[model samples]
Structure formats: C-alpha cells, structure tokens
Target: MTAITRLTVLIPEVEPAHWWQCARQNRSGAVIDRALRRHTDAVVRRLRMRS
Candidate 1:
C-alpha cells in the first residue's frame, strides 16, 4: 500500500484555478500525484544515467 502524505504548497493564482477545473473533471489529487511521480521518476533516471 502506498502511504499517503500531506503537502502544503503556495502556488500562483492561475494554478489554483487550473486545479479547480481539473477537480471538476477528475480527482485533482490523482492528477497531481501522477505528475509528481512522473517528474520524480524522470529526475531519478537522469541521475542514475550520469553514474
């Protein structure tokens, strides 16, 4: 099971409105989670490739 954690962020005004739109269509948290996971994985892959 993936352990859920809390994150607090201060984003720009435009971002919140975008997130609200995403929330209306689907789960905003899921959208954010997938984006974060993909970005993190990409960064990790890059670092590993450098080794």
Candidate 2:
C-alpha cells in the first residue's frame, strides 16, 4: 500500500458581472486576490523545496 498526499485550493466562483462590479467598487475583491496570491506562492515554494 502507498500513502497519498493531496492539496486542494478552493477558489470561490464569482460571476463575471458580479466580479466586475466588486472589483470596481469593493475591497472584497482585493482581499480575495491577496489570499489567492499567498496560496499560490506557498504551493510554489513547496514544489520547489521538493525538487
């Protein structure tokens, strides 16, 4: 038997119309964007360390 490890990133689904509206007038878009960037950076760092 083999052990398996998995990482999953859950990105919220935002409708294009709603996204555009929030991006234009709300800070929520910026917060979500920052979180995504941080998550991506951590994943990349882990991949590099493994290699």
Index of the highest-TM-score prediction: 2
Q: What's the distance in Å from true for residue 34, model 2?
A: 0.3
lDDT of 2: 0.44
Which pairs of residues collide in candidate 2? Answer: none
> lDDT (0-100) at residue 5 of candidate 1?
63
How would you encode candidate 2's per-residue C-alpha lDDT over 13-47 as one tens digit per residue? 34344444545443454466567677764322111
User: Candidate 2's error at 27, in angstroms?
Assistant: 0.6
Instruction: List the global CA lDDT of all models.
Output: 0.39, 0.44
lDDT of 1 by residue, 1-51 (tens): 999665443222222344346444434444555576666542211111110
Runs of candidate 1 exceeding 4 Å displacement: 1-26, 41-51
TM-scores vs. true structure, each candidate: 0.29, 0.29
Clashes of each: 0, 0
